[model samples]
Target: MTDTHEKRITQNASALDLAMRLRQMISAYQVSQAIHVAAALGVPDLLQDGAKPCDHLARVTGADEDGLYRLLRALAGVEIFTEVAPRTFALTPLAALLRSDVDGSLHALAVLNGQDWFWRPWGRLADGVRTGSSVFEPIFGVHFFEYLQQNPAARGVFQKALAGASSRAAVADMYDFSASRRVADIGGGHGALIAAILGKYPQVHGILLERAAVLEGARRYLESAGVLDRCDLVESDFFESISAEADTYILSQVLHDWNDEAAHRILSNCRKAMASDGKILVVERVLPESGVQKGPLMDLNILVLMGGRERTQKEYEVLLARAGFRTTRVLEMGEAWSLIEGVPAE
Candidate 1:
């Protein structure tokens, strides 16, 4: 072949590669939603004890047998489930965790993110990217939180998902509550972290702040987690007000759900309520410096859904500085999580 022709062919091939990647990236959402559907149908749970053939599993799940077979095979291809024999699938370690009855389950998140309301907002992702507004209002005729407040079942799923996302017990794995006398868990839903801290630190007391409707689960979960002895639930927006008289304040995976202005408002509230020498611990997946941090995906997810984005360490430092706090140190935890400590700036 002529040199000019070879160069043209290589350019055309690269163009094809880029186009194919774009197509696959877009269509990947279907694979995710399919997994959600399977999780909802309890497919992994059914295959827990042993493998099952397509027809039997199909009958149980009320899915088309032939179609179901293809789905199981696809999931197996991804190491989510394993097809030990033709038309028969068994649960893989990854898929087994999706079981609804599992102690730490992501089943609620799977369902919620794949449902109609959430799905619609995601469909408008490009719009959100361009406009810097929540697509939820335009698509659903109301704000995402407002919709969640009105729907009890959806609210349960959302709150449960948030609670379930973090498997660590705050007292057991996260904080040295023994050193803390009082904590303000700002935007602390389901009271998981507060409960853990209060339960572990005999001398520590806590105030859990969140929206009124969302506090139902926090109240109940805290009581169940057995930290009710030293903690009180406050029903209010964290941006509007925060609990006073706390030595430390916490914002966990919460800041990523808002724009800088909104986040500053919340942090400033925490600052106002924080004692003069008090500290604040904001827990989040601090975006990495080198590459595509998991924070970006979550940041993007929030961008599309909640009009928010996650921040890198520098970004967090800037935001905290603006909110009258100084970023002190960051401690890395499991799978893209970090506990960032900040102090009231002089």
Candidate 2:
């Protein structure tokens, strides 16, 4: 082949490859939805033991046989499942993560993603970007928290989603609870972090501050963690008052759900309720100055759903300073989150 002709052909092939990648990127949402559907239908749970035929899975899930087969085929292409036989599929390693009973399961997260409360707001992302306001209220006719308060089932799903995202074991080890006699987890839904900390430090007493509706679930989770007797589940609003004078206060993925002013107010409340020697552990995703990180996506999600934005370390420092606290240190947890330790300013 002539050099010029060969070069032209290679360029065309490269262009086609790039275009294919772009198309895949564009249709990524479809893949996410498909995984959600499989999880919602309990396909992964059903396939936990062994491979199953499409017809059987369809009958168990009350879905069309052909449709289920197509979904399984598509998911197999994505390595979420494997087609070991004709019209029969088994869970892949990735698919096993969707099983509800497994540790570190993404089942709740997948189910939440498929729910109306979570997905509908993404439809109004443009509105959120343009107005710098939450589209959730406009779309759902109520604040996100209010909606969760009214809908028990949705609230349960939301809590499970949070649990999946934040590892209690990781958060527990991120800080030193040895010095803390009383630990208060403010806005601690389900009390997972507190339970983890209290479990590790049996000498520490935990107090979980959450909404009245969520306290029941927190109680149940704490009890299951074997830390119920060491923890007190209190129903209160963090905005109004925390009403806890604990030496250590944990706000896990909490402040990121509000704008700067609101986040400052929350820190101010923590300062007000804190003991003189107390420290505030603000666990959140600290955004970088410039780069592609999951923090930006999480920031956009907060903006779309709750009118909140994730902050950088400097921003957290400023907020803590404004709230009469000093940023002592920031401990990188090696994940998307970090532990920002703040203490009462002298």
For every model shown, the clashing-pair count is 1, 0
Q: Model 1, 74-126: lDDT tens per residue?
A: 88767888888878888888888888888777777787777787777777889
TM-scores for every predicted model: 0.87, 0.97
Clashing pairs in 1: 190-218
Top candidate by lDDT = 2
Which candidate number would show the highest TM-score if scored against the true structure?
Answer: 2
The Cα RMSD of model 2 versus the native structure comes to: 1.3
> Which residue runs of candidate 2 sit more than 4 Å off their true CA positions?
none
Give the clashing residue pairs of candidate 2, or none: none
